[model samples]
Target chain A: MIQFSNYDIISNLLFATQWTILLSLAAFIGGTSVALLLTAMRLTRNPAMQTVVRIYVELFQGTPLLMQMFLCFFGLSMLGYEISAWSAAILSLTCFTSAFLVEIWRGCIDTLPKGQWEACRCLGLSFLQTLRHIILPQAIRVATAPTVGFSVQVIKGTALASVIGFVELTKVGTMLNNATFEPFKVFTLVALIYFALCYPLSLYSKHLEKKFNVSR
Target chain B: MSLVNLHQVHKYYGDLHVLKGIDLDIKAGEVVSIIGKSGSGKSTLLRCINGLEEYQQGGITVDGNEVTTEDIQVRRLALSVGMIFQNFNLFPHMTVGENIMLAPTIVLKKSKAEAEEIARAMLLKVGLEEKFDSYPEKLSGGQQQRVAIARALAMSPKVLLCDEITSALDPELVGEVLKVLEQLAKEGMTLVLVTHEMNFARDVGSKVVFMHQGKVWEEGDSKTLLSDPQTDELKQFIGAVL
Candidate 1:
């Protein structure tokens, strides 16, 4: 049996935690970009475009996250594609995050009164102009808190990438427990690290919700 | 030629017809008020003229352009017709100044300085010049509605449609908004209003149209029509309202 000193385990887990942070960032930034495109397509009022986006959202949201990671990690390999575990983890998490975000943003846009749209129309502002100037500016208020809150989910979801042999914090914790025979210590440390990362985000989101509510 | 014209116009929401066959004309520089009971289609008819609602039959033209639901055409038609909604509909996120400047800079394609210049002028006209930096939510309802008028006027439209612009204000606040509209009417800006204020309509309006069940129930000068109704609907309406 391998003897992992306490210092060895802590250093190894902390090093692996960087990957968790990096993976979460990759998923969030990519997920946000794609969500924006899908939201624009859905709001275009074109039936075909709206239908395509609706299907994409439902497909990702309805399935389990683990199943999606498995498909991206293994299914892509079987198809003769050379995707790395990092790429597969990012791909699955981005699709998962974007699906939820599109709905969150659309809800923000929907809460605006129909009169604002009519007023835009009457002002001779083109659809794009209205969206840029009036609609999005207002939607940003309601969208901020929810979007920040959803980031917490993305951080936790990166732990699932360990199943595909991605070397993130959770994966390292498992490895350390096997070597040190310290599952309680390793896993508890893992949980605390995640809480440390996500708790500030949760608090910021609550702060923003109250700030916007006051202005509203 | 009339500045605004609607001929045999009809609109339907599902199976329920809202605006039945109707014909109307308003000459240049006319202040016309549309009034009736709730669901009389006064607001719907005004909305159709501004291309906010599509009519299934007949046509509406403003400043020699036919209004249609074609995206580009409606946008083009909107250039000439500015509308004030009942709820003010000001962009709540922006300052009063930014709200007025948005359309002109974007839709009118004016330079920021020019749009700002005109926006300031419109605010001055609405008597809210000091509110240039204030956000919409910070203003009173009447102030917000006046800012909405300034927002619409920044486009320098050929016609202004007021869709019950004062309906949402407190009873005490109604006068301030009405005063701005009165000033606009005095300036020979063509105004179309859907209103519940019979006294203001009769006093300022060159023409008063009473709509009932989606048709022009009565049309005439305000004095004769309000004092002596040609139709029983107008008489009963005046009785119930006044």
Candidate 2:
């Protein structure tokens, strides 16, 4: 076993947090793009398009994220493409994030009264105009709290990428623990770092929930 | 020729026939009030006129243009017919000024300054000129209903359809909204209303229609219809509400 100084372990974990942040951001931005498309499809009058989005959502949501990561990591290898751990992690996490986000935003859209649609329709606004000017502005208020809350899940979910050899915060923690044989010290620090990132988001979400409670 | 006409219009909600063979005509400057008990299809008839509720059979024509299921045609018809709902479905996120400006700017393609000017004028018309920047949730039910009226009028519709606009307001606040409508009727805006205020119907309606079992059970001049009992249903309805 190699002996590492306390400063060395601390510096290494902090450095690894950069990868965790980058992965989380990529997953969030990409997931939201795909989720918007899914939401639009879900709202369509076409039964076939709606069914396609529904199956896609259920496929990602019904299966475990860990299993999805494995398929992207290993399944692509079987197809003769050289996939990097970073790309696989991003792909799998994006799918997982989108499934949850589509459902979250769809619930937000449904919360709007049916009369809103009728009112806009009677005003001679087109469907896209109604969504842009009327429906989405109202839905964003209902969606915001839960969306920020869900982002905390995305940040923590990046830790699972370590299992597939991605060098994120958790992977760095494991490596340090293996080298120094200090599981308790290393994992407690990892948990603290995660708490540092997530707790503020949870608080902010609650703050927003109170601020946008316009129904009352 | 009638400005608004419905010929044997029939509407259904799956197996339930809400509007069965409704025939009506309103000329320019006519104030027609539709009155009935709950489930008597009075509101449904008003909705059908605006194409808010689709009829399964027959036709609705406004200004000689037949209302159809086509989006473009409905939109064109919407430019001529404005509707006010019971719940005052103002865009909650918008200020009263913005609510009035939206349709004019987006649908009519009016310039921002033009829309704002129209909004200000309409707000003044509704006696809520000071509420230009206030959100709908900040206003009382009566104030919101008046804002809804201003929003509808901002479109410059030839005909205005109001569905139980005062039923959702407090008894004291109902008169404030009706006062605005009465003012509009005096100005010669063609108005169709489904209402529960028996007094307003008797006093202000140029034509009062009594709906029962999905048909026009009785209709005549408001003063004549309310004073003379032509049917048992009309007498019972008037008795219960009056």
Candidate 3:
């Protein structure tokens, strides 16, 4: 049996956190791009485009994130294509993050008064112009708090990438536990690292809510 | 020549008819005040004129151009017809000056300096020149409505449509907004307004239109219509609201 020192376990886990942060940023930036497209399609006057977006949102949201990761990693490989674990993890997490982000932003848009649309239209602003100039400005104010709050969820979600053999923080912690037979110390450190990453985001979201509310 | 003409215009929401074969005409510098009970289709008429709500049949001509669902035509009509709402509808996120300057800069493609100049002039016209940097939420209801009027006038529209601009204001605040409208009338701005202020309509309106049950029930010079009612519905409406 290879014995592991406390310093070795902590250091390995800290190194793995870099991967976790990288994956989280990848998923967030990618998810936001896709979410904006989904939101625009959902808001379009075309019923068919709206239905397609709705189904996409429902499929991602209704299924478990773990199942989605398995499908991307295992199912894609079974179909005779070589896929990297990194790609699988990112693809699944991005789809998962976008589904929730679209709904959150769409709710913000819906909160605006209907008269806003009418008023903008009367001013000769087209649909896209109206959205850019009027609707989105207001929606962004309402969406900021919830959007920042959801980023904490995305950071936490990066832990699930470990199950797909991504070698993130959780995967590194499990390996350390096996080598040292110290489940408590290893998992406790893992939890602490996640808390460090997420707590500031949670606090920031609350601050945004308070700031916007006061302005309103 | 009439600046706005609605000939046999009809509008429906599903099976419910909201405007029925209405014919109206207003020459330049005319102040036409439309008044009626709630659900009398007064607001719908104002919306149809601006193409915010499309009428099912007939034609609306503003400044000699027919109102259509075609994007360019509607946009052209919008250039000449400005509208204000009961709720004010000033963009809450933008400052008063930005709100006033938005359409002119974007739709009219005015330079920032030009739009700012127009915004300042319009705000001055509405007596809110001091509110350039203030957000809508920071203002009282009356002040916000005045800002909305300035925002509309920043486009230099030939005819302004106001749908109950003072209905949402508090009792004391209503007077301020109505006073601004009165000032606009004095300046010879062709105005179409849906209002609950019967006294203002009588005093300032060149023509008063009484809408009931999706039709123009009675219309005449404000003084003639207020003192002498041709229909029983007009008599009852005048009695209740007054």
Off by over 4 Å in 2: A214-216
- Residue A83 of model 2: what lDDT? 95
Report the C-alpha lDDT of model 3 over A112-199, residue by residue, as the tens digit. 9998987887788888898898999889999999999999999999899999999999999998888888899999999999999999
Off by over 4 Å in 1: none
Global Cα RMSD, each model:
1.4, 1.9, 1.7
Better by DockQ, candidate 3 or 1:
1
Instruction: List clash counts for every candidate, in order.
Output: 0, 0, 0
What TM-score does chain A of model 1 get? 0.97
lDDT of 3 by residue, B19-81 (tens): 999999999999999998889899988888887778999989999888876667778887999
Per-residue C-alpha lDDT of model 2 across residues A1-216, encoded as one tens digit per residue? 466888888889999988998999999998998999998888766899999999999999999999999999999998988899999999999999999999999999998999998888788888788889999898988999999999999999999999999999999999999888899999998888889989999999999999887464
Best by DockQ: 1
Task: Flag the better candidate by TM-score, 1 or 2.
Answer: 1
lDDT of 1 by residue, A46-147 (tens): 999999999999999999999999999999999999899999999999999999999999999999999888888888888888888888888988999999
Error of 1 at B45 (Å): 0.6
The C-alpha TM-scores of every prediction are: 0.97, 0.95, 0.95
Candidate 3 DockQ category? medium
